[model samples]
Target: MESKSKNAPAKLHLRSGDTVKVISGNAKGETGVVKKILVDKLRATVEGVNMITKHVKPNAQNPQGSIEKLEGSIHISNLQVVDPKTGEPTRTGRKLNDKGKLQRFAKKSGNFI
Candidate 1:
């Protein structure tokens, strides 16, 4: 299914461990920290988001392999940054401060994401 979002989230600005919300897909409203970024696909896998289970065969580590829960990719467009201060979804932007250091800030709370 295709996501219906007002704006596509910028991919380069996001990183692992960043908190995000699923804004316009089947998983809308679900929030989680980014676990990995699939830049080639313009998608990301967020912890606890778009989870899927896969059955596995026996292995040396697990003798009897079992089903494992794993995260699936979600299009970057469906994700929105979660404000660290307000704990609400927000947009991210970069700005140069007086110190000449470029930093990312949350548009909604005006705080660092």
Candidate 2:
């Protein structure tokens, strides 16, 4: 029953496998590869960032109940893609490449991300 913002883009500029840095929060300054994007919640799970523990009940896969540590989702606003060329966090921008295809680039280094 909730509606998304009309000004928000349908898709996030980030994708899986992209290296990103946490801009704010307890995990600030930590950089890691993006593991997954949760478009519905505008959150992304970065490797080794925002880790949390979960209690799991006994299941077929694991006969005994266990505690598991896993990466938790961080708000998209708290993440910035790391510029491959500059090795720094940078804002993302879109541009047309030689093939006239829209590609994401790092604003800081002006290089394709």
Candidate 3:
């Protein structure tokens, strides 16, 4: 179910455009940029990670059936944002920056991410 509240606490920390690491499953330790976030499903698709093969049936674009490989959605809990300063995976937290705006910070290096 979707949270109707705009101020609802974040249940997942990963976001699109973030460089994230796969912490578990088949893609463990692999890192990639987050391509998209499926908010309702609490999953994120990371570029070049968790790849899955799909059989595309004949369509307007594809005259003949073709096989394709693409990124697959991964549970948010399996992802961790890479620390900007240290280039390592770390837990993230929301905090006020120098500008007094809430931003994500790496717990390992204490750097704004």
TM-score of candidate 2 against the unseen true structure: 0.88
Of 1 and 3, which scores higher on TM-score? Answer: 3
Q: What does candidate 2's lDDT look like per residue over 1-113, in tens digits?
A: 54664455466878889999998999999999999998878889999999999999998989998999999999999999899998899999899999999999999889987
Clashes of each: 0, 0, 0
Reference-based lDDT, each prediction: 0.86, 0.90, 0.90
Write one digit per residue (lDDT tens) for candidate 1, span 8-35: 6444767888999999988999999999
TM-score, model 1 to reference: 0.80
Ranking by TM-score: 2, 3, 1
The model with the greater lDDT, 1 or 3, is: 3
lDDT of 3 by residue, 14-68 (tens): 8789999999999999999999998766789999999999999998888998999
The deviation in Å at residue 15 for candidate 3 is 1.4
- How close to the true structure is residue 19 of candidate 2, measured as C-alpha lDDT? 94
Alpha carbon lDDT at 97, candidate 1? 71
- Residue 33 CA displacement from its true place in model 2, Å: 0.7
